[model samples]
Target: MSVVVLDGSTVRSFVADEAAFSRSVDARFAALDTNGDGVLSRAELRRALESFRLLDGGGFGSTEPPPVPSEVAALYDSVFEQFDADHSGAVDHAEFRDEMRRIMLAVADGLGSQPLQVAVDDQGGSFLLEAAEHEEAMIAARVRKESKKEADGK
Candidate 1:
């Protein structure tokens, strides 16, 4: 895990970079499509969500026991419904991308402009990680530009 300082603008900036955003999202989608079918079945998505422990509110870093099985099932269904845009049984790449974009934007809106120090899994290809990496790259570029300017002046 790594701690990164980020604000809404940082996430928004990452999302605004279409190429980077699409690549990150696509990579995640591909990973979730475990069957190599070019889409995610309900089972595939459910398994991924369950493995991440994202199906229950209490599952995330909480010492509380998991929610009832039915409750978790319903929550999983709701999330799947959000991703399955056309009432289809599966989530195609476009649907997955659109839903992910919406979710990330919602997170950014909730975060607003307040910078927060968040602990994120360094190995995960999560949106927060992408945003943090983006911010770091921008900072590095600025530093390199400044150094070049100073050297040229000398």
Candidate 2:
């Protein structure tokens, strides 16, 4: 696991780079589309989401009881519906990309200006981790350039 520092701007900048964002999202989509079909069936999406454990209760201590199975099912259904768009019963790459972009932007908004330390698994497919890595690479390149310029002057 690696800890990455990221703020809203970091994610926003990543999203703004349309080509990079699309490439990442497309790669993820391809992985999820296990059947090699061009689109994601509801079962495929639900299975993937379940594997991620995103539906697991937040770490926050809640006084309320855990959600019943039906409620969980409904929530998953709703999420699938959102990604389906056009009521097409399946999620195409375009639909998946659009929804992922919206979801990432919402996460960015929630993060606001506060930098968060996130521990991510090296093999975990996280877009935020990718953004942080990209930011670090850019900073490294700039530092190298400045050092070379100073060396040339001396």
In candidate 2 the C-alpha lDDT for residue 67 amounts to 66
Q: Name model 2 segments beyond 4 Å from true.
A: 56-66, 151-154
Model 2, span 1-154: residue lDDT tens: 7899999988888888888888899989999999998999999999988987765665479665666789889988999999999999999999999999999899899989989998876785789988787778778989999999999999
Model 2 TM-score relative to the real fold: 0.87
Task: Assess each prediction's global lDDT (C-alpha) against the native.
Answer: 0.89, 0.88
Model 1 scores what on Cα lDDT?
Answer: 0.89
Task: Report RMSD for candidate 2.
Answer: 2.4
